[model samples]
Target: MVDATIGQGGHSYLFGRALGPQGVVIGFDVDEKAMEKAEERLKTLKCRVILVHSNFSQIADELNNQGIKGADFILADLGVSSPQLGASEFGLSFLEDMPLDMRIDKRIQRSAADIIKYLDEKSLADLIYQYGEDRASRRIARFIVQSRKDFPITTTGRLANVVCRALGNRGKGRSRIHPATRTFQALRIAVNDELENLKALLDSAPEVLKRGGRIAVISFHSLEDRLVKYNFRKNKEENVYEIITKKPLIPTRQEISENRRCRSAKLRIARKISEGD
Candidate 1:
């Protein structure tokens, strides 16, 4: 068993509980804080737990280093942890006035601040347009570049304000979500290389799973869901895997009503087929 994105040990604890005497579950988390908390939480569990402070994209390589060929089950939940958003220093939420630094791993050299400081107006605009699917991306990018010329756009609130101003009044639709929503998502994805890592993980998963092993992925946005859907469908075409969920399984309406953040989550599951099949 593997809990990929073991944020604060919520999923890791669940996996640990399911594991019996013969079961071994390894958890992966990029955040040091998450690892520390998960380690403590699973310490009293009956199952054997080995927590690694690393990206889930490296799960296969990590297991290989330990001479473990494959896993029976894997789960990846792709959403920023609550702590990451709640912390002002993380700059994950535009509501905060903290520095625009959204690095999941402290070791990563590049950051949201670095992209803002270096990317040209058009390049920045394209990133938001392509990655975030924001229609006002150009306006936002132009405003950001212009603002940075006179005063460096350092904080989340400052950037959010600029974006809102560029988009005109906070209309009813705009009020539904924060005006800076797309910009923050774009910056975070760029800072963490989220999509690319997921793609890499999808490409490597089949090789790291035994026959009939399950791979479940929970994605929060369209870009991620698209990648997961495409990979699952593509692998099914090659007869290497079977898609368990033809349509993505989403959270219940009740779940969404209770936790607004889970509203956008889409889960897909696939099982590896026999190599000779």
Candidate 2:
């Protein structure tokens, strides 16, 4: 079994326990902190746990390096972890005045700050529109460009402020979500190249799985969900996959009431279908 994006080993823990003493679990995570935390949690498990401090996009090569041909099960959770969002080091939350880093993988050269500082207004606007699905991307981009001229938008707070001002904040009680939410999401995705990595993972998953192996993906936003949805559908047509969840499975109401963040999550599962099938 392979747990891709094993943030804090939450999913891996259940998988490890289920596999018991006979299974081998390989987990991949780009964040060093998450890897360490998962390692500590998985230490007592009976299965052979191999944690890789790398992106799941490199799953095929990593498995090959371990003398593993294919996995029986693979799972990937595409949502940013709570720790990553809450920690100042990750720079994901606009609620705090943290430095605009937002690189889950420290090895990545460009940070959110670098992206904001370097990209031209048009490119930045396109990124916001494409990644964030924000309609006011042009206005936000113009505001950011203008704001940078004054003192450089260096912190999450400053960027958030700029976005709010650009969008004209709806006072305190009127708005449900932050005005800067979409822009911040756009920056984080751009900084991490998340969609591209997801694409790589989707492409590699089938090749790295044994015939009839199961694969599951949990995506938070429409962008990620749509990608996974269409990819699995296409693979099914090609006889490369058998879609298990014809429609995505979402969190139950009780689950969402307990954890509001899980409200947007959508789970899709598929099984590998060899040519014989």
Candidate 3:
């Protein structure tokens, strides 16, 4: 089994409990802090645990390096973990006003602040539109460009303020969510190269999984969900996989009430198919 996004090893811990001494659970994560915490949490598990401080996109290569030919199960929960979001160093949330550095992996060369400081207005707008699915990307971009001319937008609070000013009063009272949510999400996705990494992981799963092995992905946003959905459908059509969830399984109301962050999660599962099947 593989926990592709083993944030703090919550899922891995539960799965590891069911595995015996011979079973192996390989967990992958880009965040060093997360890996550390996961290592601590999974220490007592009966199964052999191998934690990799790398992105799940490299699963195939990493597994090969470890002499693993194929895995029986892979689970990827794509949502940013709560601890990560709340960590000031990550700058993932606009709600608390942190430095505009959204690199989940410190190895990344550029931060969200660097992107805001350097990217041209048009490209910025396109990135927000493409990644965030926000309709007011142009206006937001214009505001960001214009504001940066006066002073650099160097913090999450300042960026959020700029976005709010761009939308004016509509951003404050009319929306159910904070106005800066989409903009922050756009920056985080860009900084992390999240979508591309997800694509890589999806492409490699079939090759890394044993015949009849299953892969499950939990995506938080529509962009991620769409990619998972289409990829599963394509693999199914090619007879490489059997889609386990015809429609994504969403969290129950009770579950959402317990953990609000999971409200938007969509889970999709697929099983690798043998030629004979």
- Per residue, candidate 2 scores C-alpha lDDT tens digits across 1-277 of 9999898999999999999999999999999988899999999999999999888889999999999887999999996999899999888888889988899999999999998898999999999999888888999899999989888888999999998888885523345778887788888888888888999999998889999899999999998999999999999999899999989999999999999889889999999988432
Q: What is candidate 3's lDDT per residue for 1-277, written digit by digit as tens?
A: 9999999999999999998888999999999999999999999999999999998899999999999988999999996899999999998888888998999999999999999999999999999999888899999999999999999999999999999999898787766889998998998899999999999999999999999899999999999999999999999999999999989999999999999999999999999996432
lDDT of each: 0.86, 0.90, 0.93
Candidate 2 residues lying further than 4 Å off, grouped into runs, are 169-175, 275-277
The lDDT ranking, best first, is 3, 2, 1
TM-score of each: 0.96, 0.96, 0.97
Candidate 3: C-alpha lDDT: 0.93
Candidate 2, backbone clash total: 0
How far out, in Å, is residue 140 in model 3? Answer: 0.4
Query: Best by lDDT, which number?
Result: 3
- Candidate 1 colliding pairs: none
Give the better candidate number (1 or 3) by lDDT.
3
Question: What 10-residue stretch in candidate 1 is worst by lDDT?
Answer: 168-177
Model 1, range 1-277, lDDT digits (tens) per residue? 8888888888877777777667788888889987888888888788888878888888878888767777888899996987889887677878778888899889999878789889999999999998888988988899999988988887888888888888877423655778888888888888899999899889888988889899999998999999999999999999888999989999999999999989889999999996722
